[model samples]
Target: MHLIYLDEAGNSGTNLDDPHQPIHTVCGVIVKDSQWLPIETQIDALIAHLVPRVADREGFEFHNSDIFQGHGFFKGWPWPTRVDALERLLDIIVTNKLPIVWGAVDKQKHKAKYVYPAAPHDMAFLLCAERAERWFKNHAKDDVGMFIADDTKAKSDMKKSFKEYRKTIALGNRKECLEHIIDTIHFADSRETFGISFRMRLTISSSGILWAPLELSPFLSELNGMYMQEGCFRKKGAAK
Candidate 1:
């Protein structure tokens, strides 16, 4: 059996006319319940190995304000430290070949055109859920249970989205698997942070191959490129 958690980053609330900023990203992770502990241990070890000076708390203290500040601990690193951390985290998940599946969505192009049954965040959540469901279908021998950390202001919204997604799947759409039994819990920080904690015991499910949206893929790829190029480094004026 597998339990997966979903989460996103960036602003999905931006308007189409917002010239200053226009990209929203949804990031996620799927991990086996048993593997959570070993993965945390590995993450702790990695942080200790790569950044021994910062306190252990520092590793978990990522937030949007800090990342956007442009010059604190995040900006100090060559890459936005948080994004870099996320990348490193993903690398670990992939390298360990943890059963965990992960992905993201960028709303740059679909800003005004895409209209879904849920809010932007809920849409993001659905995207991750669909990705995980496909992953489990291909990799796991048994059914996979999904858990998403609630970020919605209204809990009912999340539930509604899940229900709608289930309907879509039941209809044999095959476009994406949005409908799956999902449980949501509220956690501090984004769900991806929690997903990152469980790195060692991760296992990929066996249901089907999970592929990201073709349209959103380019934006996510670009964000990753930016993180690698300049976002990872510590900026001149970020939070301390």
Candidate 2:
């Protein structure tokens, strides 16, 4: 069995016209059940190494935005130091050869393209789920997959969208019926789940793929190898 840790970045809800956040991205990292512990331990060690002075690392959460924007624990940290930490975190994913899947929605293009555009969150989540299902079908045919997503205020909304996809044709595409993903999404707090926390950077970096590719090239370039290419990163149903 496989557990897909899901997270989102740049979510502006129904207000897709937000000038600052023009894109919404949902990302999933697929981990085999057997390898989950080893990966968690690696992340725990990295956290300790990064914050050696913090006695209580148990409550510490690695927020990508915080680390990048010099907020929270990262405040007063030098630019190179902050960037180095993020790069080290990325190394964990690369070293483990984890497969990543993402769905990024360009809100302006999405809204203009459809008379009644699907909500950005809804579209992005559905796209990620679809790609996840396809990944299992292609690479891990015998294994079942599940989603463990970060608990957000939009939990009910996301659940509603997921339920619709699980039972019906989704995103105006007749081919989508997510049979590989077992049951509904399992939402959990990022503070408690290392799987979800480690994959959070993928969501933030995915938005960068559409928003500021050059600024995030180092991160995205490394991520390109991990991303499942069959779906090829969706943007309004078009593959990149």
Candidate 3:
């Protein structure tokens, strides 16, 4: 089975007024069961490389906000050092050829466009889930897929949304069934799950690309290679 580990960034629930987080993004990294261990090992090694002095690396979490802002475990690290660490993490995904599936929503636009807009978290989850189902159907036809999201304050609401998605066609011009994805989404603590941590970094980096493209273009260019283009649920005539 393929496991799609998930994480999100810029989540403000139903409140679309947060100026700092004008968009909400949900990202998932697809890794086959057989490939998960190798990815986890590389992530562990990177953590060791980041903090060699710590004897037990079990608690080290790869949070992009902290890593980017030089906070938490990444505090006191130089800018170049932090950037290098993030790049190295990205390298693991590149080397593994993992397929990244993500969904992002511009809060203001979505709110204005709908009579009663779905919360950004809900909309992003559906989009991400749609592509994840597409991935299993197109790329891994013989295998089933599972979803695991990092535990967040939006867990209860997201769980409700997930159930509805599994039961009906998503709101779109075409039918988007999430049947290929088996079971309910398992919510795990990011600090304990390497895959979730990997996902956390990806979501943040992707959100950065959306909101601050000029500053994150280099990372964006590097990340483009990992997206599952064929699995993307783009509208007709949408730019690739």
Candidate 4:
């Protein structure tokens, strides 16, 4: 079995008029069951190295907003420190050769021009989940894929979408031929789940080119290139 962590990059809800969130993306960071422990160990080791230098910090989570603006525990940290820490965290994925499957929807473009019955956030998430299952089929046969998402009020909304997906896919009524997915996607706070936290950081860092106004070319370039090397879902199409 394979466990995948899902997270959103920019969620504008149903309101496309929200300028700050013009784009919405959902990404699932998937790794084989055997790789989880080693990756967790490596993440711990990296955090250990950075802790002694930054005081009053233990059990620190790698959040994009905090690292971007140097908030909370990052307030007094130098710019270089933040950059280095994020780089190392991203590097853990490459060092372990894990694959990331993501789906991005242009909210301003999609909702502004098209009509859909479902929420854009739920749609993007379900699409990403579809992609994750497809990638699992391509790489692993007969292995079930489970999803984990950030806990929210819409957690039930996401579950409903997944239920609908299974219904359609089962009856051969869906546009996307999705299968091999677990029934429910477990939800928990980001701070509680390392896998979800890892995927959130990946989603935010990888989305630098999308909504983040900052010039994160180096960040996206490094992470995207490495993810490609490890096999990522082809954008606007099926997995390669």
Ranking by lDDT: 2, 3, 4, 1
Candidate 1: lDDT over CA atoms?
Answer: 0.48
The parts of candidate 1 lying over 4 Å away from their true place are 20-23, 50-59, 62-88, 98-118, 150-156, 169-180, 185-193, 196-240
**Best candidate, lDDT:** 2
Predicted candidate 2 versus true structure: per-residue lDDT over 24-93, tens digit per residue = 8888988888988998899888888888876757577778888778998788989778777777777777
Greater TM-score among 1 and 3 belongs to 3
Q: Deviation in angstroms for 220 in model 4?
A: 4.7
27: Cα error in model 4, Å: 0.9
Q: What lDDT tens digits, residue by residue, belong to model 3 across residues 1-240?
A: 888999887888789878877878888888899998888888878888888877756578778888778898788989888778877887787788778888888888888898999789888888888878877777887888888988777678777788889876546568776778888888888888778777643333323353321333344444545463322223334454
How much lDDT does each candidate structure score? 0.48, 0.76, 0.75, 0.68
lDDT of model number 4: 0.68
| Position 29, candidate 4: lDDT | 82
Angstrom error of the Cα, residue 116, model 2: value is 1.9
lDDT string for model 4 (112-178, tens) is 5666635678767766777776686778767877888888888887888788776554313646555
Candidate 3, which segments miss by more than 4 Å at Cα?
A: 56-58, 200-220, 224-240
Question: After superposing candidate 4, which stretches have Cα over 4 Å from the reference?
Answer: 53-59, 115-117, 169-177, 200-240
Query: C-alpha displacement of 149 in model 1, angstroms?
Result: 2.5
**Deviation of model 2 at 200, angstroms:** 4.4
